[model samples]
Each structure stands twice: as C-alpha cells, then as structure tokens.
Target: MSLTSVFNIAGTGMSAQSTRLNTISSNIANAETVSSSIDQTYRARHPVFATVFQNAQGGNNGSLFADKDQSGAGVQVMGIVEDQSSLMARYEPNHPAANEAGYVYYPNVNVVEEMADMISASRAFQTNVEMMNTAKQMMQRVLTLGQ
Candidate 1:
C-alpha cells in the first residue's frame, strides 16, 4: 500500500462514520414521536457499509500480472435500512394522535441505544481523523529525510 492510500482509507472511514452519526441523530430525534398509525410511526434507521477493494492492476491499467494480494482500498456505504422491530403502542385515550382503540403508536427508536451508537460513531470519526493526521505527519517526515 502506498502512503497516499492511507488518506483515502481514512477518508472513507470518516465518511462512513458521518453517515452513522446522522442515522443515530435521526433515531434519537424521533425516539419520543407518537403516531396515530403503525405505518406513520418512525423506524430506527441504520447505515450499512462495505469494504471497497482497490483494483489489482491500479488506475485501470490492464496489466498482465496484476497484484492480487493488495488489501482493501476503502469503505463504501451500502444503504440505510430501517429496523424491523415492532413499534411501541401506548394507551393514551385523551391524546389527539391516539387511534380509535385509544392506543398511540410510538416510534421504534430507542433513545439509549441511539445515544450509544452516536458515541461509538463519534469515536470512530475521531479515530479516522487521527489516522489521517498521522499519515500526513509521516509524509512530512519522509520529505525532510533528504534535507
């Protein structure tokens, strides 16, 4: 792996963590939201990620002997998926959003879980930033070696 590729790998990690943080924020924001129907209730969203492999030949050059042992290039966001867990149903007869049966459907989002996820994503983002900074420092040191 080249020194420059470190930046790409860390950049992708930061991007993925950003997406994760966004989803956690959304989940936390809707944790207490109540809906009149199950269909309208908010479902906790999570972002899926996948490893992006670098082209063995590099830069699209069709080399006869491509390096097959090359490691991962970066990470990519697959998609955001909604949780399939059941929504919370509460008996609030006087609530305006309650259904005919006096039941109000709450979002499936769990505040505690969302908060934990937020913390984890934030830590991951910080780690990626640190990795990028370290790579930059290493490159700078390399440049000074010949001086």
Candidate 2:
C-alpha cells in the first residue's frame, strides 16, 4: 500500500470506532431506565463491523505476472443493533412503573458491561489515532529526505 493509503485506513478506523462509542454511550445512558411494558423498554445496542478489503494480485514468480494484491483498507460499521437478550425484571411494589404484580421491567443495558465496552472502544480509537500519527511521522521523515 502507498503512504497515502495510511490516512484513508486510519480515517475509516476512527469513523468506525466513533460509531461503536456512540452505541456504547447510548447503552450506558439508558442502563438505569425502567419501563412498565416490554415494548417501551430500551435495549442495549452494539455496532457491527466489517473489514474493507482490496483485491491483491498473486505473488510474483519468474514469469511475467502480477503479484497478489490484497489488503484491508480499514473497518466499517455494518449497523447498530439492539441486544436480543431479555430485559431485566425486578419486583418493586413501591415503584411507579411497577405492574399489577409489582414487577418493573428495566432496560437490558448493563452499566458495568457498557462501561467496559466504552473503554475498549475508546482505546481502540486512541490506537487508531496513534497509528495515524506514526504514519504522519513516517511521511514527514520521507519528505525530509528531499532536503
């Protein structure tokens, strides 16, 4: 890949991670929310990812031939999806949203899990930024060679 491809790769990575973080944030924010009905309750969401790849040619031999060219450009967010897991149910007769049976339905979002996911997403994003900086430094060094 060319030096310029680095920027494209890093940019895509950052964008993908940003989307992941957004979903995580939403999940965390709604973690404590309670509802009277299952239909109205919030569920934790997660971002799906896909890798963008370039067709690489086959490796070079002795005969005239194109080398295998294949590499990932970066990651992409396929979509954000709600967790299909069951929602949390608690018995709280004093709660406003409790049902006739004194049961309250809460969002499936687990604050601890969401917080961990946020940390992971943030670290991945920071790593991508670091990769871009390294790529930038390398490019700068190459330009310095022209001096």
| Top TM-score model | 1
Residue-wise C-alpha lDDT for candidate 2, range 35-127, written one tens digit per residue: 888888998889999887754233232323224444776788888888999999999999999988998999988788888888998998899
Q: In candidate 2, residue 138 scores what lDDT?
A: 97
| Cα lDDT listed for each candidate | 0.88, 0.83
After superposition, which runs of candidate 1 have C-alpha atoms over 4 Å from their true positions? 56-70
Clashing pairs in 2: 56-68, 56-69, 56-70, 57-67, 57-68, 57-69, 58-67, 58-68, 59-68
Supply candidate 2's per-residue lDDT for 10.
88
- lDDT, candidate 2, residue 3? 77
TM-score, per-candidate, Cα-based: 0.91, 0.87
Q: Residue pairs in steric clash, candidate 1?
A: none
Residue by residue across 1-147, what tens digits does model 1's lDDT show? 688989999999999999999889888888889998999889999999998876732552343444654477899999999999998999999999999999999988878878888889999999999999999999999999999
After superposing candidate 2, which stretches have Cα over 4 Å from the reference? 56-69
